[model samples]
Target: MLSTAAVSWKEPNVECSIDIGLCPNIKYKHKTAQRRLTLFEDFVAFGGVCVSWRLVMAALKKDFNMLPRVPWLMLAEKDDGSNLRDFYCPMKCKNIYRSMLPKASGKRFFSSQGWLLTIAADHEVNLLHPLSRVQILLPNLTTFSNLEEMATHCTDKLYHNFIQKAVLSSSPSTTSDYAIMVIHGAISKLAFYRRGDNAWTTIETWLSAYSDVIYHEGRFYAIDCWGRIVVCDVNGSCPTRGQIMPVMPNEFTHSLEKLYLVESLGKLLIVLRQGVTTRDDYTHGTTRLRVFELNWEEVQSLGNRALFLGFNSSFSVEASNEIKANCIYFTDDCFEAYYSASFADEGAPNYHPEGGGKDMGIFNLSDGSIEPHFRGRSFDPLSPPMWVTPSF
Candidate 1:
């Protein structure tokens, strides 16, 4: 179990919450630096424990790996009867936070640029910001283009299952001129919706089986399963067709293929991640890396920078910013592909969704060393935990 438990970030009342005072021996613990990790949800409540602890917290601000920090792993919510969500800081502090989020009840979460897209049990959709706690109602996606005949199947959760992946052109909190795109349906397809739009407009394109989509250079780019890309300018109701690029060279194809599209510096990149041969485990571990430039050319390195790749918005950061440079921080994105508990047959393998989270790690690009990013409970199948960059 993690050091953290179910605790509210809110100011606790005098009845239930206990105040933590800094003892005279705290200096000795601070000097030795061997104390157990202390977990709290909010800095206000945490620092307000006592005057001495407040001063201690103020002095610890230079750690640079705490809450309100960017690139946090929004942990997968467990049914621990807390009715709260968890967020883990993986850089240095290694602190786990539990927050009361009633709006997220029975909802699956998808993230992009710190904004989360919540799919309710009844198929209602909403965009939420965790830090600001802002909610924006998006058009409910209860239907798909290819699966027109929904009478035979269960209506509620069937449509959401078809949604393979989603990404944003920009966060709504930052700009009004932003778009929401998703790859959905039985055969993966691209769809987009702008702010204040009542309906999601499906992009008319022949290129299908898209695994991932990313917004780069003012256009939406979707990558198919066969390493092909389609760049299209998503607009109003009358959507335009995307210009499909030629199939990329399949030089790094393997058994379980995964590709991510991201903007490293000022250039577009397609990162290919395949399994290692020596490993016999069912969980996918990344060994080799094949990075490509947008011009169909291969690149050598991401100098002085680190990449955060997962279900959320894939982004790159400068290593000078106290971040682990040239490492890929990935989460439990392979859960749906590997574990389908709801869709499994009677005699299918007993694969749990939480088991696939073991694949989450930091893969060093330089020497290819893989290390655990977060040590905690595994993730849920539908709304697995992922990398979320706070944009406040």
Candidate 2:
């Protein structure tokens, strides 16, 4: 269905295995001045150096509402294994469907390009397409050196639970030469695996721990707990780390805040979540929000783009009349201690006691105001909610 070529880059004394075979020469059928459409067109050409044309067309067609309906978030009831529901806030419509894979009891760690990265009970990793019911099993968790030792000591489950996030280099729907990168281990080590790799290659970094990662501009950029950014070359024999970006100034005192990295309008952004801890249960309630654009190692304000954050994934969509600019729609799952404890049930509904109020809400960047998005409905703290962009 597609053609391929072998592309190799050489750096003196270093081994590199970068694959650019899937990178297609994209052509536009029509020209338009619309900024969103132009941006999407450029993203297809330059975002990921190895993205296929089929993947680009599929993503753009679905995202731009060219299909019957634009994709919306799907919330899976944790306890119910038989059905899944789609929540469309813009259309105020809800559609229920049978579970695509009822036997997948793994906790979802990341979502990107219409794929969900999950870890099963036996510690196996998979990229699942919920609508198509397609699953790609990646290198098992036991393939990691440290995790293997933990498995030998009967503590693999405890260590495997540390993997909180993952991202795909390219959508598997169109390319078989994609890679999966994940942040795992007790101290948050970075590792990546390609399609044919027998094991994941870990990238060595000086940072103590990493918070989030995103693939942008032909490389992987990750943020540490202390707000430091590290870039990685994923295709190398042993993925090497590039220079660290400057850290942003701290404005909040709470140590429980969450950090996320998202690509918006061809630029990279770092979002910081500020919250207050309840004295009794220690659950977090968002108090303020801050967004900064990473411009050549400096941080600036994010202009005109609204961000969406959740445990499954973080991404940016254009601001319209319905979705205001300079705001964040966040879910309840912040990967807190209480929620992690419920992984045994694969983050089933009501695994932990409900907190003070629903954690899903919208935060305004200009005035620091918080408002509930789903009124009067409290979500399970452990299960939280995931923002799913449908693809079929």
Candidate 3:
């Protein structure tokens, strides 16, 4: 139970109401008084972690641009690594649990239709509603494992290297809708999950491509390693078995490292990242950020933009470098992107020679500049991680 106190403020011909929550001296806008009153009165847990509570309220004001109205407690992974615990934030905190799922390392969450799709390690996927915590696991199951004998025999591990990238998308078919995931390893595999039936089906081919999966215009599309942009007609009644249609005018191939899909200007936009060539003098390294229209006609590079920070200006032009990308995220408006500096090539001698510029940063395409945000671990190790949506 939370004890409550109210403070009334009066100024020259002005009056206001300040409703108190667990935090002291906290004031609320008078017009939204009822909401503020409810938050503190209804949800304050005396024994809860105070830092988490304050952090949640601060995040709500910063990210959502809304005042803390009602304190809504949510289940979250504790910063102390104590599994899951109940913590409260302003009622409007969006998808609080979504970021926690990855740390749990038990289920993965993908968002669609205002619900989240959660898949266990075994590929047992479930659809969950974030607020209500309602879940329905899809019945279909697909498991991938490398051959034990071959894995053990080979000095270099290749089996676990089956697919370098995995993404999920929901496509509408004439009969119904399904979730399509593109798995790219030594082989390219398209796996489909039928809703209501809870089953998974896979189609394999020698596309041997690494690309980002994009859901657009009721279909799924990707630019393969060969720079061939392929689009699959998801509306097909049966499992996708026919030839995939090519929509791009020219085959554009690059050592694409990252893929991002954004729906903009009434069409789909694909952003691809390719390694920059080093000059013979080895003065600077280059990376390309390519944007393609849905029709795959006009492809343009953002021009020497360092998509990942650590690789900027360090490598010799002629030398080959495998750029690693940490996590990639986009703002809600999709006009900007934020990527982590850590790459996959941590062991390479010249890797991140610049000490990995910043842990995380923000990029605004409008200005073509990146603002780095560096937070030391001691600041707030358990500060709630950003948005994690439950799968439904």
The predictions' CA RMSDs to the true structure, in order, are 7.9, 12.6, 12.0
lDDT of 2 by residue, 1-392 (tens): 11111211121111222122333454445332123332221222222233464454445444533322323444544455544433334322222322335534435445777787877656677888765568887887778756553543345454334566778887787789788778887777788888898887778787868878888877888888777888887775546565588775654324536778988888788877776333355455677766666642334444676788776557877776456677788876555534543433555543345422256688887777888665534344323456666554
For each predicted model, how many residue pairs clash, with residues at least 3 apart or on different chains? 0, 0, 27
lDDT per residue as tens, model 1, 1-392: 11244445343422222223334534443432322223223443344445565565555533422433346788766776676777776645465655566777667777897788888877777888775568988888654454573344467666446566778888786588888899776677888878877877777778747878998888888888778889888762335688888767555444337777888888889887776222335335566666787655876678877888877878887663336877777876764555554356688654563434556787787777888877776667667678877543
Q: How close is candidate 1 to the true structure, as a TM-score?
A: 0.78
List candidate 2 segments past 4 Å from native: 1-71, 78-90, 94-99, 103-106, 148-160, 250-256, 276-281, 295-303, 340-351, 354-357, 376-383
TM-score of each: 0.78, 0.71, 0.49
lDDT of 3: 0.35
* Global CA lDDT computed for model 2: 0.59
Superposition error at 314 for model 3 (Å)? 30
What ordering of candidates by lDDT runs from best to worst? Answer: 1, 2, 3
Candidate 3, 375: how far from true, in Å? 4.3
> Scored by CA lDDT, what does every candidate get?
0.67, 0.59, 0.35
Ranking by TM-score: 1, 2, 3
Pick the TM-score winner. 1
